[model samples]
Target chain A: MRLARLPWWAIIIVAGLAIVFYSFFTSPLYRRALIFVTDDPRLTTTRFANVIYDVRTDEGGIRRVEGVFVGQRGDILNVETSRQVTIRVPRADIAALSCEPPASEGDCPVDATITLLRAQISGFLIFEDMGRFRIVTDDGERQEVRKFDVIIDAVQRTPENCPPSPEARCRVVLPLNPEREANQLSGTVLEANADDFLIELAPEVIVPVRQSDIVAVVRYTPAECALNNLVGCDSGIFLTLFVAVIAFALAVVIGLVAGLMRISDNPILYNAATVYVEVLRGVPLLVTLLFVNFALYVWLRDEFPKIAPTLQLIIAALALIVALSQAWSKRALLKSEPSSFWQPIVAAAIMGTTLVAVTGLFAANSDLPPLSRGILGLAICYGAYLAELFRAGIQSIGRGQMEAARSLGMSYLQAMRYIILPQAFRVVLPPLGNEFIAMLKDTALLTVIALPEMTQRARIFAADTFRVFEPYITIGALYLCMTLLLSVLVRAAERRLALPR
Target chain B: MAETPIILVQNVSKHFRTPRGVVHALRNVSLEVYPREVITIIGPSGSGKSTLLRCINRLETFDSGAIIVDGIALDTAANINRVRAEVGMVFQSFNLFPNYTALENICLAQRVVRKRSRKEAIEIARALLAKVGIPEKADAYPGQLSGGQQQRVAIARALAMQPKIMLFDEPTSALDPEMIKEVLDVMLQLAAEGMTMLVVSHEMGFARAAASRAIFMDQGEIVEQGDPQTLFTAPQSERMKIFLSKIIKH
Candidate 1:
């Protein structure tokens, strides 16, 4: 009786959650750890944390030491070694600190504040805080993000061996298949726009490729792309799978209900379903996500920042509550020894985690998490398509079923429930399963909104490691595994429910 | 037979708009069936036999004409369902709800339309199953049943509705030769029990034994109609002779 009453998988899930929380919240780096760097993290020292230093000793050889950063005493910088021993460094002897160029006196204050803030958060990289670049001149640093054109124009480097002014010597790459080599033009870039691109391959020879034709603007060197690369946090496949499953679940419910409405006799219901299907179908998913994630999200934040995130949090919290409680319910959770006592705390923790995630979403100036935007976008889009599939499935049932039901006095809705949909579902299951696999792949599109799903997350790792092939190969295998697994599941379901011969 | 007709048809014509052209399936057909009349309709393919049967229950609406079943006029979509409920139909392909057990097939409409409780519906289903001589197969799905058994289940499903009239559109035509007997036996029992029925079948034996009247149709029109014995023995239209000679040889 006790065994039967015990909730299945509840203990395992709870234990898993506990381990995850421990690994994440404690000092141990959970899979992917985010680290952010300021423009020049040089001479300025504020909040002391671990730092690697290249120090020139009196013997004239450089020595590397890991130590805590201490504030500068005049021209001599103070430092504490890992051995608890204090050390002093004159400005001339201090060769390098944290791989950053020496910051001017004016830059030190901002750098100090950033370093202090970073230390306070235990070195976690909030997406918004990451990759923030600002131009700092001797006069006074402008308090704004550097635009692309400005950076391209101003930062011509002597070491890069490029022309001192204006045109950038770059390698322009065009999209190419594996069968062909990548089309690259090593030339001086003259001008580029949405429509046209002009590159001077040689002084006399100018090659023009359409912007639409270009695959990528290859950087001078394969270096760290902070926007696309990260060392650790999550392989982030779960984010993709989670959003896909949730969106698909939502889509199924919406599809079936709305699909029935389309064929229903009532004009209001029929017209409403028809309009929903037509409008949603017409609007491209990419456009919808972009609008919802950026424009819509920004407007909401600007107009009602407090209310927007609050309302979002409430919705997220309630959803989490429902989901977690349902999952935990198998344990007879509230009725169990720890439950009634531990329930509120667990509930709070769930809410807190979700809230943190939501906050992080906006922290990147993305307004909402890319996953949230992806889910809504995919669900609505797929729901429209599925509605059509469902309509066709329902129609495929023999007219005699309806006739049989109607002749026996069953109303249209009743006939559908009892006789029609069950048959339609049987016919539709295979296609619906195919749609699910398709949806799993489509989750990759959510990366446009910058969700750190597999493709987006792997690209981030690839940019960081400068190993494009390995990350891309891993991504391909992951997607293949997911789709294959989904196919197998669908087949198994079909087999289990196969009609007797 | 009752003085008042239980099923009435007057100048019913139906045309289907196909991609090729509009095909007139039923042309100015007129027929009346009194209470407890077992009328058998036999015709070549595309002769409007099944189309006419469908028209009675308003499953296939006539382009023009009037069909009154159980005194209710099948004139408007609003009243069509009510009229349909009084007329039960069995199809050539059985058209049994594939996902449901034979028992559930019988009970579904009874519970939904008649507001019968689960227990009452089950009881009615079981009784109809027994009447159809397949009570043991009540729990079996249509897919699991033989063609003959499926047709019987379809009959039982219709019977459970307690409809005033039953229409069968070539019920045994899709069945194997050996399976035809089981379905015909159930129809014979229904005819003996005096259920008003309209059947379209090629089986002249069943027509002669059970039908009060036999109708011969060709080119979307009734070629001839009479008592089955007279219709079969006496010479009438050329179409009737050709149809009967073709069917009766078997």
Candidate 2:
């Protein structure tokens, strides 16, 4: 084709490239090559574009500029006066053109220093010397100016320096189920620290409070400069994403194991799977959910707290190590030399012990609300469904495939890893896509346990505004769009898989 | 006869315990296949021809029998993987892993089972694909290939492991009549290269042209055994004669 007959898109792209090239060459990073350094003061007034900077002769002095420039010639400054005369001044007579004056003005007699309180101070402040403060004024100057000069423009208030007395009555809230008659501790603010404070109900009863109690400390009597700010409704998305991500990731692994157990030849595996399916799969998801949130999780945090979960992690580590070694070891357990085989085992034992020991150091009350407990509960619930999906996908593969793999001397795990599972994944793609959508919706149920997901977040807004129609409609549309996006992704994957290798 | 048998099947019998009754798939089926010998078993369906071949690779478990392949006793040891590694089997349906490319199907078993490095496995797979005369189809998925091409890939997949013996259970039976020749031709090439093979098929021409020994089976038992020339031209048993006559009529 002739260059003039090129496609519209090609012409457009070439035009865009030319524009980009011009912009790139003219950019500030390449300014040295393009920009002319001028000291000519009279060049300020121009038909040709130029910059005029008004600079202070001395520090703390104002410099100003005048007029939309009319014209300039041969370094002569034509100043357009407000009275209408275009006053011309010779460039030789002008001093210097600059943006700002050099430095701070005269010092305050050597003994004066200041702590600048520029913006509004947030939260409470402890015992700090409040003298000779430097601040940024509305006029946009950072200086240690006279305080009495600004006192007329500010609300002068008396300062309270004394700590709250032991007899000072207050209410304390702990981290627990808000519905239950728990977490409410009535006390007095005894003393304050950098992060937390000591509170006392009576003279001899004092309790140390940690910041993560997510507390709001109130005084019985108001102070001189008391501040109360309303922090808005936040059903944080990070918290929701955290729960969904952990739940889904764990569920996939759990599903794989349970599905394998169902297909295993051992009677123990078969019986274990039967029990898992009958009890967890048969029971209502709500029952297990509530029980974990209200009962078990509470007990772990409040009663036997640290011991139970730490022990479980230790056991989990041990089981994982054992399973990995048994499945993938290159050497036969009996035939291999002890030093070669036992090294990994010893290392794993040491690691597991260290894990247990590390967990012991922190008296971590799983202060996690149902937000986290719901993650655990949901993973267990969905894992069962995914297992059945996995089993169906696995079983649908031709028996000849397994025979072919095994005839190649591959172990059961090897065959499953290399051959069977990869094929099964292809077969189960549409169903797995559906499961992801189901999982996204299931996260909404977490709100029943008082954890906020998207629906719960919208509900809060709806409740506050008393406008159900708009919020729900907006949320429904958002959810449908998200699901449609997921569908698009799944369809793309299907199309990719359908392509010839 | 001086060289040890590549495959020795002794008194092998297998029965299926279906809901209806115990259907005997194999009954006292014994045979020896020597090194570089190509043996073909011809019979009608349900005559234990496929069962007897599958037993050598322990793909089917026998009720009472012994199958020794490459000096490793099958079913008598915990690790049948050793026996499996030396003996490769190709199926009638091709049984190529649908997820993998023709080259990947060949490379997978070599990497996973034989523990060949990726580069080494790919090199061998490409060679085998070339040997099967579809060198350009190395990157094509099994689903993208024709029946003959897919079967050739399956044969190459089996060959990639460098098995001591190759089992073909009606390899050409599932192919289109036109496509059957391509698969049979590859098998004939493998035979010419002195690969020990045991095939079960009703392809009289393949049996006559390629096989060193021919066996006839019926009612889950071997009815007649001899050279391809002796069996095809002059049958010994009444069942063999009737089976040949029926096949010839078709």
On TM-score, the leading prediction is 2
Candidate 1, residues A1-501, lDDT tens digits: the string is: 265564778456445545544544452223232121111122333324334556555565655544444345545544445322111112221222231233543122211211100000011111112233232212222222222212223333333533211111221111112221111223333443332223343443112222333233332121122223221123266566777899999899779867876876445457778999999889987787777777876675566555556767775666466445544543433332233335444544664576567555554454555556678778888999899999889889988787777777776667778788877878899889999998898888877877767778776765654445445555665576568678879998888767665
Error of 1 at A450 (Å): 3.3
lDDT per residue for candidate 1 within B1-250, as digits (tens), equals: 5499988888999998999999999999999899999999988999999999988876676778888888888755556767776788898888888887889889888888878999999999999899889899988988899999999999988888788899999998899999999889999999999999999988888998999999989878988988999989995888888877876766
Which pairs, if any, clash in model 2? A300-A305
RMSD of every candidate to native, in Å, equals 21.9, 20.2
Q: What does candidate 2's lDDT look like per residue over A1-501, in tens digits?
A: 476987898677557545544643554212211111111112122222122335233454534433323344444434333322111111221122111122233211111221111212112121112332233222222233232323323422223333311111211111122222211222333433343223343432112222233122221221111012111112434344557678888888778767766765445455676678667788777787888788977676666554657575866676465545634562444331233345445544654565466455323646665656898888888888888888888899889888888777776667788888887888778777777777776777777787766667666655643445544544454455557678768887877766364
Instruction: Kindly give the number of clashing pairs for every candidate.
Output: 7, 1
Show where candidate 1 strays beyond 4 Å: A1-235, A246-388, A467-485, B19-22, B76-79
